[model samples]
Target: MKQVLSLWIGWRFYMARQSNRFISFISFASTAGIALGVAVLIIALSAMNGFERELEQRLLGVVPHGELTGVNEPIHQWQNIAQDASLIDGIVAAAPFVRISGLIQKPGGFQGLSVVGIQPDLEAKVSSIAQFMPKQSWQALAQGDKNNIVLGKGLADSLGLAIGDTLSLYTPSMGATKAQRIGAAKSHRFIVAGIFEIGGEMDLGTAYVPMDYAADILGLGDGVSGVRIKVDDVFAAPRLIRDLGYSQQQYMYLSDWTRTQGHLYQDIQLVRAVMYLVLALVIAVACFNIVSTLVMAVRDKQSEIAILLTMGMAKATVMGIFVVQGALNGILGCLIGGALGVLVALNLSSIASSIEQMLSVQLLSADVYFIDFLPSQLVLQDVALVISLALCMSLLSTIYPAWKASRVHPAMALAGR
Candidate 1:
C-alpha cells in the first residue's frame, strides 16, 4: 500500500510540474492526436449510419414489404389469399394487384411505364402511396366513372401531362388472328387523376389505375399478377416470405422488399466497412505519436527513475505509474472528442448547409442525391469502441517505455545527469 501511494504521488508530481516545456508540448500533442482520431471516426461512422437509414426509409416508402405471386397457376381466389395472409402474425395489409408493362403517350412524347392496378380503398392500408399524392386523390382513381389514372411525378413531367390531361396507354395483347404475334396491341385512354412524388425511381416510372381497367388492358381474365403484403416489421419479411412459400408449395412465388433491394443494401455495407478501415488508419498513426511521446518521457526521466528504483519502488509499480499517466491522457482525449462528435452529429445538417452556402456549391442536392441534407446517427457502441481502443493504445504505448525506465541503472543515470 505504501509503495502504491508513493508511486501515485510521484506520478502526480511529474504531471503537475510546470518546469518542462518540451514535455508539456509533447503531452499536448499526444492528447490532441487521440482526440482528432476519435472525432473523425465518430463523424465518418455517423454519416454512414445516417445514409443507411435514409436508404431504408426511401426504399420501404415506395416498395411493398412482401409480394406473393402465382408460380404455375393463376391466383384466381385472391379474396381467400388476402384473408389468409392477413391472419399471418406480422401482416398489416394484403392487397391484390395486377402489374402491366406499357408506354404512356402524350401529344408529342412517350415514355415507358409500369402500370399497377389496385383496389384503392385496400391499397391505402397497404402502402404509403396514399400519403404521398401531390394532387388529386387515391380514392378518386378507383371511381369507375372517372377513368382516372395516377401518374408518378417524373412520368407526368416526362410525358408533359398534368392533372385532368388525357394520356393514352399502349399494352401488348394477343389478337383474335390465328397467326398473330404472341400478344396483340391494346390501347386505352385515361384521365390523369393524380400525381405522386415518393422521391425515388417509383416516382419516375410507376402509374396506378383501377384494377378492372388494368385487368382488361392486360388481357388478364379475372387474374391478378400478385398480392402485395404490408408487414408491421420489415426485418421479419424474409422469414415470413420463406414460411409463406413453404405453406403454398408449387402455387406461389414469394418475395420480400429486402430481396428487391438487397444488392444496393449490400453495397452500402461494403462501402461502410472500407470507409472504417481507411479511417482507422488515422487512429493507428495517432497511436504511433503516443508511443513516441511516452518513449521520450522515459528517456528524459531516466535519472529520476534510477533514484526511485534505488529508494524502493518495484519495477512493476514503476511500469504502472507510466501506464496510468498514459491512460489519463487517453481518457481526457476520448471524453472531449466524444462530446464534440455528438454535438457535431446532432447539428450536421445545419453545419453542412452552412458550408455549402459558404462554398457556393450544394453538397447534397436533391436533384443529384436521394436526400437533401447531411445525415448523422451517433451510435453508442461506436462511441464505446473508440474510447476502449484509445485507452488500449495508450496502455500499449507505455509497455516498451516503462520497460526501458525499469532497466535504468543508478550509476549510469546519475553519471549522465
Candidate 2:
C-alpha cells in the first residue's frame, strides 16, 4: 500500500512540476538533449555498419583473398600449383596470373600501373570482377589476342581510350653486365577490347590481357608470376595462405587482402569506437541535467514534502517519489528519439541521394572511397543498447536529488515555507 501511494504521488509531482516555469524549461531542455544525442549516435553507427558491408562486397569481392607470387622468377608449374591450392580445406579457387609493371602512353605523358594477364575461365572462379563485367568484355581475353587488352573505365577515360583503340605498354629494364645505366625499353602495342568499371581506384591503375601474351613478352617461357587464391573466409586468408604455401615446396612470396587493404578496415573500426565513446558522454551529460531539474523541484516543493512527512510518510517513500518523477523525463526522451532514429536509419541512403541531388554535391566519391553513396543498416541490437544505456543514466541521475528530498526535516522545511 505504501509503495502504491509513493508511485501515485510521484506521478502527480511529475505532472505538477510544470507550474514552475524555469524548472519546466530545464526539464524540457534535458529531454531534448538526450533525444538529439541518441538520434545522431544511431545514425553514425548505422553509417559505419553500411561502410563495413561495402568493404566486404565491393572491395574484397574483386581483390583476391590471398596470393602466392614466385620469388625472382615465374612459376613454371603454375597449373599444378593452382590445382594443389584449390584442394586445401579453406581454399576455394586459384588462378594463374602474369604481372607486368608497365606504362601506358597518354596525352604527351605516361601513366604507370600494373598490367596483369589472366585467363578468363580460371579468373571467374577466383575473382568476382568478372561477375560485374560484361560477357564480351571479360571473354575477349580468352580469344588469345596478344594485341588485345581490357582496363577499367577510369583508366580508359583518363587516357582517352575506348574499344578498338590501340595503346602502347612499355617496361624499362637494365642492360647486360649488371649496369644500372639506362637500357633498352621493351614496348608492346595492344588494342583495347573492353572497358570495365568497378567504382574504385583499381579502375584507374590496373589493366588485364591474355596470360600467354604476358608470358611471351616477358620471356617467362610458359611460366606465371603468381597464382591468385580465393578462400571461403576472408579473415582466415592470412593463415590459410601460409598453409597453402607449406603444401607447395616452392619458396614463394605469400600475400593477403589484410596486407593490401587492411588499413581501410582498421580506419572504419577506429571511427566506430570513437563514435560510441563520444556519444555515450553526450548522453551522460544530458542525463546529468536531470539532477539539476530534480534539485529545483525538491526546493520548490519543500512545504509539500513537510506535509507528507507529518502525515507519517516513510523517508524511503519520499525518495521513490522524486526518482519516479525524474525518470519519467528519461523515458519520454528515449521513446521519441528511438522512434525517430529508426525512421531515419531506414531511409538514410535515399535521403542522402536526395540531398546530393538537391545540393549538387557529392558526399562520397568513388575515386577516394570504395563506395560513392551513404548506406545504412538498422540493427535492433544497437537500438536496444543505446536506449538501455540512456535509461540507466537517467535513473542514476535521480538518486542524489531524491536522497536530498528524503532528508528534509519536516519542521525545518515547514518553517522555511
Best by lDDT: 2
Worst window of 10 by summed lDDT in candidate 2: 174-183
Over the stretch 242-343, how does candidate 1's per-residue lDDT look in tens digits?
Answer: 766566534788899888777667877897788778766766666666667667777777877788888887887777767666666777778887888777
Model 1 misplaced regions, further than 4 Å? 1-29, 71-74, 87-90, 105-110, 134-136, 153-168, 173-187, 219-222, 232-236, 246-252, 353-374
Score candidate 2 by TM-score against the native. Answer: 0.90
What local lDDT does model 1 show for residue 226? 86
The digit string of per-residue lDDT tens for model 2 on 1-417 reads 878887899999989978999999999988998898788788888889888887888789888899999997779998888778867888999999999997777888878889889998889888888866678888888976456788888888888888999988878653434353225567788899999887767788888899888888888887899999999999999999998888877789999999999999999999999999999899999998999999999999999999999999999999999999989989988988888888899899999999999999999886798777888988889989889999999999999999999999999998884
TM-score of each: 0.81, 0.90
Best by TM-score: 2
Instruction: Give model 2's clash tally.
Output: 0
